[model samples]
Target: MEKQGQRCSGLVLVPCPFQGHINPMLQLGAILHSKGFSITIAHSQFNSPNPSNHPNFTFLPIQDGQTDHDATSTDFISLITALNVNLVFPLQESLAQMIKQEEKKERITCVIYDAIMYKAEEAANHLKLQTIVLVTNSAATRLTHFTYPQLQAEGYIPPKDSMLRDLVPGLHPFRFKDLTILNFPNLEALLQLIATTIKIRTSSAIICNTVDCLEQPFLAQLKKQYQVPIFSMGPFHKIAPPSSSSLLKEDTSCITWLDKQAPKSVIYVSIGSAASIDGRELIETAWGLANSKPHFLWVIRPGSVRGLGWRELLPECFKKAVEERGCIVEWAPQKEVLAHVAVGGFWSHCGWNSILESICEGVPMICQPCFGDQRLNARYVSHVWKVGLELDNELERGEIERAIRRLMASKECEEVRQRATDLKVKVEHSIREGGSSYNSLDDLVNHILSI
Candidate 1:
């Protein structure tokens, strides 16, 4: 155990570059730092986190050979493939250099990396340093990756429309349609990426950003599948002191607007950073919010709507409605927005981070999952957790209005709100002293030291 007033060991954290992935990795860094670990962040050049925000930690940028154009132009599979291949040598060299420099000082203990950055594990293994995999998504989502091969062999990969409504063989609460097999242009590449990421390799442990109460079943299954010690120490944002981790600038004015709204009267809407919509879907969404009775704060991320500038394609009637009851920004401080007393519901992409944030704040959701694990997360939120409603159909004004009403204004809303609040309380207990997450974090620290 780390002694009081003595720095224990140095850790190098490698985060995947996306906003959702970056937040938890950095928050984990913050938590370890508070526990007396010297922190070093080794990140890809693409979407590098700003060092100014975390002055205490050292930042090492690995050359990924990806320009801004490549990040924008390439498909998801291509980008990931490029990253996995391009980063291996550069990262190895960087770690080797760090090992040489820190030989006499606080020795580098282990490389804790995002699950997608498998190259980090290889690099650390070459140097005979310990490694840990940090899974940012829910345990249920990780289970899907572990079972992908079996799912494919069972003819569930290219899911038949006939089996869409049926539950997966062993994965309860997840229908065939709810699987994370996103419609990528290169299916083989995506499959390979999933296969590669699921391998435990030489890592010493797996750290998940989830609470035991939420996905205890799936976590248990994962424990049986992997030989390494699995730590469910999570809700990292709550465990660590808050910092600015957003790559996009957040519009703080929405919080001021939220202050004027009645308690639990506003519904916050954001589809997260990666998902994009066409002009038609955007129009439908605009009218849907306009028709719904609750005041709304919507984040229209720049370039998220295809073939149109931000809000330029919003119908005139919708614009008029915004003057009365809506506020739209390019991006929002989502955690802050969800935590505000006035936010009654969230219309989200059902990204794992978004779902956890909403649950943490006792805010229910209107789930509109776009791709990948989002559909699975949405299914769990609406069906398993009973804290949110899912919008599983095409975007239409009336449907959207009704979904919002169901989540915010209808009679069932209170039940869902209470459930969300109840879950929030459970999550709070999980992070308090002697709670599951707290103890898991302690165990994680000891495990790292043991290595």
Candidate 2:
């Protein structure tokens, strides 16, 4: 009661399965918890996934305080629950009950839903929980999904082989052949993605992990279509305190390494945990960066190493080159790396979190989108946003080499860099006092409080 009295509100966030959704959603929740909202983050226990908790946060297992938290102001969770009908019911039930209980004792003002997690929103609707969908992808990507039906009707999507083809008209065309080659094993998942977009479009509210300035036109278009209100309160990032159990740990060694490099001299490369690449392609990209002779920080998740697993060995030449001017780690403090003075460009898988963070940091991209909507994001970055160059699916060192030089050292690179910096400033302003994102966030708060 006292904690509620101090903060006067609370939140419950449900994140979709997988690292991409969980990581960024967790970051956003933390920021909200800091802003005087008591938070509940629900996760599935089916995967036995770890929340890898932070202070005043939790994992909603069958553990203590899972459905019971009468604690202090700042509380958050990383939902690790499975996305099945059975699991979702109990989780949702628990959420409604928790909020009711909290409301009785104090207050839980809102329910934040993961964009594709339909069950969460259903639960929110049932309980009359003021709902907000958290879109971890670019607003443009949501536009793609929302616009998919139109695209399909207009002959932009065709049935190819066993999968649906995406005939992305302009610079790059997409087909089902690429889906299989890129390992989209689940057609059901694709349909769910499209379905999720339908829900988001008609949704009364949304909380995107983007700033309105970075995607001004799309944000405008989105508002024009569904004026239910939208908020872009991020690339919300912060430095870790020396005093807490951090959400993602940092390695200061990389910062020391970055210091030795010249200003805007290093390339930051991370495919994110969900992106996969073959060993042959990995070697190809390694050699590509080496040949470019640029300083780099490369994150190679063990999960990405397929056939032989992480046990698989890289060629000695690649290792020697990595040692020469590169730092390779399993995971990285991504936000910090982007904020660093040395990072000039990013070689990325074009995940939404990576893209938005890079944009907010004023860094341009060498986009090598792996699969999913990353391909879409890559296309927009190069063609629409004009903030990046594409590293297509050729799997060759020379192509990688050329793209790096063009992005990091050429006149084309400067144009991309300028656009990137301009967008970054714009996004920052949008979340500042009276900015669109800021105002939207406040409006969201008022709506929930009304509820």
Model 1 misplaced stretches (Cα beyond 4 Å):
1-8
Clashing pairs in 2: 42-79, 43-79, 43-80, 43-81, 44-80, 44-81
Tens-digit lDDT track of model 2 for 91-183: 667876676566454566677777766667776667766677787877766665565565557744444445534444431343433322234
TM-score of each: 0.97, 0.82
Q: For residues 1-451, what per-residue lDDT tens digits would candidate 1 score against the true structure?
A: 4566644599999999999999999999999999888999999999999999999899999999998888887488778778878998899999899877874448899999999998889888899999999999999989878777887887778777788889988888898888888565677778898899988988989999999999999999999999999999989999999898999999999999999999999999999989999999998898898888789999999989999785579868778767869898999999999999999999999999999999999999999999989999999999999999999899999999999999998789999999999999999999999999999999999999887
RMSD of each: 1.5, 6.5
Clashes of 1: 0
Model 2 misplaced stretches (Cα beyond 4 Å): 1-7, 46-53, 62-82, 96-105, 153-156, 159-189, 200-204, 224-227, 238-252, 309-312, 321-323
